[model samples]
Target chain A: MSIGIIGAGQLGRMMALAGYPLGLRFTFLDKSKDTPGAQVGDIVLGDFMQAEDIRRLAGEVELLTYDVENVPVQALREAAGDTPVHPAPAILEAAQDRLDEKQAFARHGIETAPYRPVDSKEALETAIEALGMPAVLKRRRLGYDGRGQHFIRAAADIETAWEALKGAPLILEGFVDFDREVSLIGVRNRSGETAFYPLSENSHEDGILRLSVAPAGQPALQSEAETQLKALMEDHGYAGILTVEYFEKDGRLIANEMAPRVHNSGHWTIEGAATSQFENHLRGILDLPLGSTRPRGHAAMINCLGRMPALEPVIRFADTHYHDYGKSPRPRRKLGHITVVRDDRASLDAVITELMPLIKAAEGGE
Target chain B: MSIGIIGAGQLGRMMALAGYPLGLRFTFLDKSKDTPGAQVGDIVLGDFMQAEDIRRLAGEVELLTYDVENVPVQALREAAGDTPVHPAPAILEAAQDRLDEKQAFARHGIETAPYRPVDSKEALETAIEALGMPAVLKRRRLGYDGRGQHFIRAAADIETAWEALKGAPLILEGFVDFDREVSLIGVRNRSGETAFYPLSENSHEDGILRLSVAPAGQPALQSEAETQLKALMEDHGYAGILTVEYFEKDGRLIANEMAPRVHNSGHWTIEGAATSQFENHLRGILDLPLGSTRPRGHAAMINCLGRMPALEPVIRFADTHYHDYGKSPRPRRKLGHITVVRDDRASLDAVITELMPLIKAAEGGE
Candidate 1:
């Protein structure tokens, strides 16, 4: 069976790599044939945002899914026709806007930082006064990797934040003094079979993910997160992978944002877990039996931003795997990643520390 | 960089899959685009035996390698001009014939069954008389999986065995039947670095491999096999995976044959070891540092002959990985394989016992 992927980025490439062993083929829809996905699979040369292109791809495959979250939901709904689109267009619509996403979390009783929609300067003032002095003003749609948002620290900065993000649908959220960030990656099929990988503790620098370590959250926190995700998935009648990024403060998880796709935080599952998230995502979308999500070892995945480290230096370490996305070097791009698995967390941390210098040196050299 | 593979079978398909993560591309030369390797990589549609086709592929890629054993060594040597070929054509030339292979093994101090070249009926009789009653006559070239051979049990069977194999260049050998079979997979790089996976105990039915269990032999046996393989690789200045199959009789290993590429017995290394043989093969030929060959857990790889079992039923077992080569079903043809990894050997055995019936039932249905 062939799967049609709307956006042919590295995620689609990895998915194709994982799905091939299961005897599945992939066709990718993107503007250019020079993408990571296009390198490994058939390409449909067209824009993913265009309804006509999506329909063409949908017509060629048994099912449709996507890599990028910015795809227009209305186009997807209209183009999918009889072909099933996993993670459903309805959920994509909610995930596209911040206010809608928060409301969806509220309906499931999932806690989030207090927020209010702001459409005008007067509304922004009202939201800031009600929430607190420290708040964030963000464009409600198309924000990712810390872009399209500004921080409001004092009364003087409210206008500055507004002036920066004006003329767009916006949201004001109360500032969260988060202890750490973690993400839960879960999958559900049409048959109602659900499975989840252990929560991964993530660290970010300058709005982009820098590192992730798996099996980080407490057992209670993991179960609580799973319960929350399960309710949300059932509500959307979801299939395929769903990821929710959360902030942990005072032993509680505060909802931050969610993505209806395979996540960077779960990349360690490729070698750390019994089954990879990419393979599970395919299985979930096809309504095949869910694979075991048990952890194989303590794993740490570090993202290679802007430039990838030399392959020879990185692979010299034992149990270390390097992934180059077959992409050209660009500043702050999701160029590639390196994963290291160890018998214990201490060893994993030690290796990550030793390897970080080599990775940083490459970034500096570039 | 792109690597050119001569024959696009399951081994080449697997090599391409493993190399993708290392930021490498592949171009395969084969008769049809419907092959397993062609499904995942670019294909140069041509016959592997044709020198002109091999030259065309060599001109397109940086280096070349072969998947099938019968690649006509003279053609490879002539066609691969300036483009390096791993496991050099010299090794291929020796491995193509049984007599040359036995002589090569002896040169490395590797012991093998007593054998003699047989041309006429009188020569066959003399060989059988010297070797005694249970003996075998095998064609010197292009024989595999129990094909092109006949067994001679007594005097009456001598003429029958000679008649069956008389037309081709042949060899008569004493059969070793005391114990189980095992194979050692080893790799060496141009930089003279070498690594070896633990010996795998294998089982065969009708001279075809049915199952392989890794980390099977004693430490002494493993070290001895590794030493023997190291000597052979050093002699050849090999730069890729090389496998040596043995007949273990009364705790001593008798060399049966050797393959100049990755062996089926090493398939368990895909998940059971820290790095798969396929990936290591790429690293070796590229002269990059070889990966760790440490076994992660007890692993058993079962070949799916003629037909593949249902994906859902096979993946339901935790730690089980399914690999379908996307080949059309043919009687006794190797279609795909399933690998199951466990924390211990006993549990691994138990799961294999449970999974066999399901796998066999599919073959029967087909």
Candidate 2:
């Protein structure tokens, strides 16, 4: 069977690679003719917002999905009329808008940070009063990876934050003091079979993910977070991979955000888990039996960004594994990632500890 | 740097897939334009034996290798002058000719089945008198998977065997009462570092490989066999994947034959080993440090031949992994394989035990 995916980026390319072994073909729709996924996919080059592109993609595939959520919800709904779109357009709509997402979590009895919708100057004034100073003002829709968001650390910063938002629909969220961030990635098939990968502790620098350690550091917190995420997916009848970002503070896990598709933090699954998140996503979408989720070992994944040439030392480590995404070396571009899996947490920690030094050496040689 | 492979069959396709995460690009040369590997590779279509095609491929790649040994050596030599054809022409020549291979083994003090060269009727008579009846007649070159060989069971069978292999250079050998069959797959780099995968106990039906169980059944015998094979590779300065077939009888390992490229029996390494044989082969040929040969777990690999729809049951088992080669369906064609890996040998045995019932079910469905 064939699958249609919107946004032909690295995620779609990886999905295509994972799906090939299962006898599934993928057709990717994108605005650019040479998007990363198009390198190994059947491409339909047209605007993602255009009805004709959506129609063409839906006509050729047995199922429909997305690599990114920026596609217009109307376009997805129209395409869903022909082929089944897993996770549904409603889920995408809720996820795309920060205000709607937070409200939805509250409705489901999930814990989330305090937030208030701010669509105009008057709304911002009322939200600031209730939320107090030192809050984050973010565009309600289309914000990702810390983009389209600004922190209001003082009373003097509120007006600047409002102006920086460029008159977009926005939300003001009260800051939550948390110790560390983690994520739970799970997959559910059409038959209601759910599989959860071990939770991963994530670290980010300047808002871009830097490292992820799987089976997270805290076992009780990981299990509790996974159980909570799986319960949410089950309640929604979600079919496909679901990633729930969370914060741990004083031994309590708080929901931070959710992604209906595969997330970057789960990349270590490619080498550490019995089945990768990408492969599990395909299996879920295809209504196939889910593979094992048990991890092969403790794994640490480090993202390769900017002009880093960290391949030499990474390649020298017996346990270190490199995965180059085959993209041009643009600044801050995610060219690849290195995953090192070992029997103990200490071994994995040792690899992560040396990541910076190795990257520096590779950069120096280049 | 990029490498060019001369066939887009499963071997070349697998090599390309393995190379993907390593940031290695491959250009595949094949007659079929839409070979499986072509979906993810740069394909150059033309006759592999043509001088112009060889020259173009050589110009496009930094290194050259063949996915199969059938590639005409003369064309390769002309295209890759000092570029290094891994396993080299000398290795291929020895492997291609049975008489030459046996002589070389003898020269190296390796034990092999008793055999004699036969180029004419007089030579055949001399061979028969020396080897006795209940022997086999085989063409000296261009034989694979049971092709180009026949058994001479009785006096009447001699005429038929001779008629079958009339005009080709041949060898006659007395049969050995082997208890089982095994193979050792190893890699050697230019730096003289050698890595050997655990021995695989193989089972065949009509000379076609049916199954391979890694770490074999006899650990001590397997280890001894691997030691012998490693010595042979080091002695030859071999710099790629090598498969050596052996016969075990009365607790003794006897050399049967050898192939200087990736072999079907080593397919389990994809899921069982820390690094796959295909990736190691590339690392070896590139003179990079050899990867760890540690097996992740006990693994059983079963080849899928003909149009059997056995994927469902095999996938149902939690540990079972599948690989489909995407070849046109034929009665006895090897389209893919399934690998099952587990923490212990008992679990592997249990998986294989479950496999028998599923194979029977598939046959009944057919």
Candidate 3:
């Protein structure tokens, strides 16, 4: 009767909040008692990678899932005997490694930035020569949100980039000349049914997402993204939400990465879509029929980084929805976010213009 | 920093769910630990009348409110030394007693059913003589959803009605010949700013609310309800949401009763209005700016009683939102509710027609 989660972060907290309305119970496996999910549910504090903890959690609940992709995949397989782990753990393995993810995309005929593995200093030198200059050298494992990455510009910069990333299993990649960055959320069920929310135009600064605008409405761009995502879902036999990030270049969508869970980019769907990604994820994993994925209207979500905003006045804005993560504020931390949805594009644009400054002010900017 | 509610029923649970997105915390006081609110927040298990418990809760939270109106008023006043209670304890006193409620309406020149207090069998006899042959006699307090009252249809039925009602103070009233029953939700904050959600036509079965259709949209009918509610809110210096039920007869709005909390009729606003009543109540109680209460086109909410409905299929309905109370189902107990919202009237009506029988089947009706 209870849905068990491997991580009890804010996403799990939101999943619990969304699930409670449909009469679902929740228990979370978290190493710390201080997580957001622990604030609202039953939690077992233990390391997610520990086999004993995963077995203990599975013994308590029959269905298992993870909010974050950092869980140990082998430990998940041990727990997947009597309990089914949605997203299948293999998807997590693929998504967690940069090279494996790119290989999967390549095999599926999906275009990605050209990349070659670099396991040693000699291999790094060979990959740089093969891929050319002004590329990015990244750790293949455990990298997220621009962390564990170094930019290789000219020949002079290769030594510094190597010095920064040579300690880990690395990949050297070509740079993308992208016009804009966008992402699409697709959900599939056990019955092989699928639904896709509209494409969202995303803007990031310093590798942190700053804003997301839904239904970026370029039909051709969205259709192309959908085709690629549908094939990827079927390839993995995935049963839940999958978010694929893309770079729009020459009016074509090139796949960059995919997340095997409900994503921050889809947060606008809570108010903008008829069925939110969180709800659909639960429904999909439970094998329930997927709800409608249609966008209600134009919506924009602005992330509050570093600190809680001066939200007292911000909430007064019409059609604005605000959420605070309840985590202690720290520099560059995702403290909270707000969404503004409207029936018209002009009204939505006006609100976005008015809100971005407030968001910036909250982040200690001019 | 947090809102303290005197009772931890499902309403408090819903209030917490609504408030969490706005960066608010909640603590609840309830007699049972098994209630829905206990599942989500800090709860104190004690009687609402226990002064020590009340003092303990007040010590922790400076802003106090209640979900259910039946809390001990004097205890609430005792708890209000440094804390402020929204809608005030006096409004609760007025709303609790039928005689006082009628008197308040009369003082404001509001039209209500013709009535007189019946303290004894002699008083009942006199009231029947003065009022008419067909009348309803109701107890003064602690009665809801038709729990109290007996109908006196003829002279021969007087003794039995008096015998059934003689145990407590009562009121004899002439029932209105109404065309339809409708309720309006009006919220006012500390700054005297007021906003009203559109009138909702409500249908009740056995005096329990069954359905509410938002924006009944007869301008003349709505203006009258708004005028009377504004007078009542100003009269009491009320802060928070108040739901006033009215009867529309001969195109004239007749006052029936009012509740001093976020009400069942307004639950449709969670996804159908620009602002939900739970959020507006928090805003009003915190002296924050009230959000817009404009209905988004049309909405209908169906209350599920007695048993849990088969909702996996129901959730797939487009634009339909469901909430289960997370309580064990009991006969005649309100287990949960569903709301169907749309941007057009015909679509809403169509869903309502399609859903009503399913709801009735869930309630063991059809």
All candidates: TM-score of chain A: 0.99, 0.95, 0.97
Could you give the CAPRI-style class of model 2?
medium
lDDT of 2 at A325: 74
**lDDT score for candidate 2 against the true structure:** 0.82
Across A20-43, the per-residue lDDT of candidate 2 in tens digits comes to: 766667789997755777766788
Cα error, candidate 1, residue A1 (Å): 1.1
Q: After superposition, how far is residue A218 of candidate 2 from its true place, in Å?
A: 4.3
Pairwise lDDT winner, candidates 1 and 3? 1
TM-score of each: 0.99, 0.96, 0.97
DockQ (Cα-based) for each candidate: 0.87, 0.63, 0.75
Give the winner by lDDT. 1
Q: Model 3 clash tally?
A: 0
**Cα lDDT tens digits for candidate 1, B80-129:** 99999998999988999999999999998898999989999999989988
DockQ of 1: 0.87
lDDT for model 1:
0.94
Query: Candidate 2 regions off by >4 Å?
Result: A31-34, A217-219, A308-310, A360-366, B81-84, B217-223, B308-310, B360-366
Candidate 3 on A1-366: residue-level lDDT in tens?
688998898788888878888888788998876677777777988888887898888888868988988888987898657888898899999999998999888888989988889988788888888888778999988888789988888988888888887778899888887999999999999888899999999999898898999989488878888888999999988899999999888888888999999999999998888888998999888888898898878999888888877767787788788888777778888877898989888999999898888788777852
Model 2 shows how many backbone clashes?
A: 0
All candidates: CA RMSD (Å): 1.1, 2.1, 1.7
